[model samples]
Target chain A: MTTEKINNISVTTLANVYFDGKCISYGITYADGSKKSVGVILPASLTFSTGAPEIMECVGGACDYKLPGSDNWVRSEAGEKFSIPGNAKFDIRVAQGFAAYHYICHFG
Target chain B: MTTEKINNISVTTLANVYFDGKCISYGITYADGSKKSVGVILPASLTFSTGAPEIMECVGGACDYKLPGSDNWVRSEAGEKFSIPGNAKFDIRVAQGFAAYHYICHFG
Candidate 1:
């Protein structure tokens, strides 16, 4: 995960309005209108829908995931990244039992 | 954790220059003189010396730690923050077995 902080950029948090306690993410915006989010996903299987093209970067633990139209689940580990197109959905499962998946979601 | 990004700041990465593969942290500098870092610590018992005051915020997992002169270990969970004085050495241990410790380090 990238840890560089720019001088002019501010960090904003996102409210957890959906999925209650299972998932949480915060939103960040760049000066040029680019946006990013960092959040944690607890152990569970979930399907997520995205409205914008998103690049998800695993920052802490590994997660097993199956993208839209795929039946095979692939594992994504820390320091790795994957992309999902806008209007698409993804199936993600965190099977590490006690390990919560930490990630950064970048909007394109 | 705050996830909002400002428009003017740039993200930079830090080279892992020490401790081999046990611990890793990335340095992020604000537009001002302030700096921050986000990293993950694998399971281990380590003692570290710091040159500046640091506010360590837990982001993903829990850690068992004994600061400076204390003999007792305390548990710090995700979303909690702890502070260490400059030039102080503290002992940190991660016993979660598989859960890596993720954190944000703020300099003062």
Candidate 2:
């Protein structure tokens, strides 16, 4: 897709809410038909398992994430990106001062 | 609505894309049955008319807005909120150094 199409893609209403609303995100389809996501995570520690390899980008606020097999959680601020392997689960936490942690998850 | 419900509310798929894709947003519903919105605005100036009074909150990045009948544009930084009356139109402009503006619009 061109640059213009990516900025104005439609926001898909379909979503999944997990852990009693702790982990929430919405579905989005690019012009070429690949599906992705963008959502906000509240200040809480949660674990998520993804079926596909994902590129998780931190676009807003602050978050700490531990990829699978890692013992220590690393800080992620706005504008940072991380790659998580497919079929793997990771842990996320948000500390004080951030209203909500916003992110974009890219899937193939 | 309770605090937990608000953060994890599902991101709705249904949306309206206007201005040849200049303004894009998603639909959200509070637990109290009121409709709201959350989306990103690209770096461009656009005009919008609202059908209901909207509380425009700046969650990410910066923007300048001019309410109905106003000649000056006021700057809105992150964590700032503005109220736009129903049936009024406003102008929004985003300038340098910000990627995309993220916002939450509340309607009663």
Candidate 3:
């Protein structure tokens, strides 16, 4: 099921704007100090590198993602998730007229 | 002082995209069921109509706003705020090449 909301957490008021505002995210912290980010990627093809391992959980909309070392592009829709290893890079894209991809990024 | 973060709240995972993605916001709910939103407005001039009264609190960046019936534009920066009455309209603009306006919207 889609995680429509995250309850009882702290949210950073400022946003992280990437790719000239094509992607925006707000940092969130849980009671136990675990960090996550809720973000949206507009219709654009973008490459990203990760420092920590990341689990991208789709909360709304969808995107096609290309994982490291894989030529295959996979679709992740609402309620679905995909993982990326630490110190790796990946590609994510939304079609020009498609809706933005809204996701929760869990970091470890 | 600026509110860098809001603790012990619930955040909606899906984002609200406005002006063709020029503005994006995330809804947040407090324990008492109070609703607020954290948002960023890219460098654009936009007119907005309000249903409920709204207080725009700057968390980062800045904007020049013109309230209803006002011919003058007023600048509001981080740590500043502006209020608009219900059933009213207002104009806000961030200059081109300037940073996006980041704010918390309190509605009543």
Q: Per-prediction DockQ, in order?
A: 0.17, 0.04, 0.96
How good is the docking of model 1, as DockQ? 0.17
Full-model lDDT for every candidate: 0.66, 0.67, 0.97
> What's the interface RMS deviation of candidate 1?
8.4
**Top candidate by lDDT:** 3
Model 3 scores a C-alpha lDDT of 0.97
Residues A1-108 of candidate 2: C-alpha lDDT, one tens digit per residue: 111122324454323445544445666655565767876666689898979899877766668999999999998877788889999999999875555666778874
Encode model 1's per-residue lDDT on B1-108: one tens digit a residue. 432222344434222322433455545566665667665566678787889988888776768778888888888877888888999998788874557666677787
Candidate 3, residues B1-108, lDDT tens digits: the string is 999999999999999999989899999999999999999999999999899999999999999999999999999999999999999999999999999999999999
Interface RMSD of 3: 0.4
| Residue clash pairs of candidate 3 | none
Better of 1 and 3 by lDDT: 3
A18-89, model 1: which lDDT tens digit per residue? 353356554556666666766666677889999998888887767888888889999887788888889999
Q: Candidate 3: TM-score? A: 0.99
Chain B vs. true chain B: TM-score for each candidate? 0.85, 0.84, 0.98
**Alpha-carbon deviation at B32 in model 2, angstroms:** 30
Models ranked on TM-score: 3, 2, 1
